[model samples]
Target: MKIIGIITSPRKEGNTAWIVNKILEGAKERGAETQVWYFGDLDIQPCRGCWGCHKGDRGCVIKDDMQKLNDAIDHANAIVFGSPIYMMQMSAQAKIFIDRMFARFSPRYSPYFKAENAAQKKLILAFNQGNPDSGLFQSYIDYTKHMFELLEFEVKEVPVVTGMRNGPAHEREDLRTLLKDIGSSLVGE
Candidate 1:
């Protein structure tokens, strides 16, 4: 199985990336083909409210890096999404990436909608927050979980790491072990 990791933090070598790498490490240890994407390094344009994909086109129409990203997602059996909490929501980069998935929503509203079955695909959400308490981001977390559910991903885990402004997440042994365990569970290791 191929597992893809996406980091949406704008900061180079940011905490969210560090955590995502750790998860990928565990997946690699289990012999799963893995790929990672730093969204900050990609030119993922915001959605243009165009219904091209919904109206008989195969995929998105904005014609940027998102198409490649979507292709990777289409082939992956599992996905790990890492994003830093910004103002109690996912970072702008992550939000834009999610918004670009508007094409997947059309079968419900349009007669021209072409539905793709992305169900049963495993998904893990990792969020890094400045607040010490994870409880503060419950609503935001809930929204994320619900959104992914709507998109047909089999939500496996939502791991939130709080109070991460001082250091990289790689140095946190507890988180490292937790993420590693999550990764192993992905391939039934």
Candidate 2:
């Protein structure tokens, strides 16, 4: 199965990114082809309120890079989304990406979702916070989980890494272990 890993941290190499790469490593070990997107590198425009995308053959009249991203998501068998926690919410980059999925809400194009059978690709969410108190991030996490469920993704359990406030935090053995399990599960699915 093809698995797409989306890293939403602006840091070139931050705690969130480190965890995502580790997951990719684990996913690769499981023989799944992988594509990783450094979200910070992209010029992802926010979804406008235009109803054009819902208007017939023309989808997402904004006409930016979102279409290609959507196509990739449609093609993938599984998805792993990793984002840094900002004010107890996902980073702006990740939020915009999720909002752009408004194009998918309408059945303008087929194959992304089989509404009849309710069959969909598996999805996993991974998040990280610098603080050890992960409790604050729960509400945002649940919202993301709900978003995926509405999108027809059969969600795998969300695994988040917290207490990583700074670098060298990757040195922690627990981070390695948790990411390893979550990443491996992505593949075995």
Candidate 3:
């Protein structure tokens, strides 16, 4: 099996990346091929609202690293999205990435609305917030779930680490163990 992890944080090796890597470690242990894509490192352009991809070939018109990202997502058996909440929502990077996925789906009124591979992808959605209370970010998480569902991804785990700004996540054994356990469970031991 192949698993792709997409990190949407501007900060490298930050809380977001750390959590994704920990999950990848578990998948790796199960002999799953794993890769991580840092959105900040890629030159992804915003969707232009063109319906070109919905035509014959079904490919995006904008040319950039998004082609590579799309290829990765197309082949992966599972995907993990990691991002830190910003202003009560997912980071701009994450939102842009999701928006770009418009190429993967045709208009709802169209005859070919859903892709053939739709509903075949298993997804893990993770988030890190600065607030001590993670409950405040439930709306953000729910919104993310809705977006992934629109993409036809079966969301599984949503490991959230809250109040990390007050204390480094490395010092929080509870959070560390939670991430590791979630990772192990992803591949079913």
Candidate 4:
């Protein structure tokens, strides 16, 4: 199996990336190939809501970093998305990446999946939040979950670590263990 990890935190080597790496490490240990993409390094522009993809276009009308990212996403067997929470939601960087999925939008996605018998990919979400309050992160988590479902992917896991406003949240033992378990579960081992 192959897994593609998309890092959405602007902070390089931040807590979110640490956790996502652990999960990827676990997947690799289980003998899967993996690739990582950092959104912070890309110059992705936000969606214009043009609906160009709805008309049979396979890519975004905007010439930006999203198209390249989308190509990688299309080739991967599984996907991992990680981000830092901002205002109780994913960071602006993460939102831009999500909005870029417009390239895959259309009623044809369903028909295409059926015609090709699309592989059921394991979708994983990792989030680091500044707020320790669970309620503060629920909306973002819920939205991420919904996005995965709508994309026709099976949710393998969504593990969130909070209270990182001060330091590395993934350093906490609880969070590390949670991420490890999520990775292990994905491998069915």
Highest lDDT model number: 1
lDDT (Cα, tens digit) per residue for candidate 1, span 42-139: 99998887678777757777879987888899899999999999988999999899888786664463334433745568899989997788799898
lDDT of 2 by residue, 1-189 (tens): 788888888985887778778877777888888888887777789878777767785877776677667777877888888888888788999889877777666443343555432247787788888788768778878978887787777888787777776545478887776776776787754
- Model 3: per-residue lDDT, tens digit, 39-117? 7799998888777878788488999998999889889888989999899888998888877887777567243246665
Clashing pairs for model 3 are: none
Worst 10 residues of 2 by lDDT: 109-118
- Full-model lDDT, candidate 1: 0.84
Clashes of each: 0, 0, 0, 0
Which pairs of residues collide in candidate 1?
Answer: none
C-alpha-based local distance difference test score of model 3: 0.82
TM-score of 1: 0.91
Ranking by lDDT: 1, 3, 2, 4
Model 2 steric clash total: 0
The TM-scores of all predictions, comma-separated, are 0.91, 0.88, 0.91, 0.85
For candidate 3, the per-residue lDDT at 116 reads 63
The positional error of residue 188 in candidate 3, measured at the CA in angstroms, is 4.1
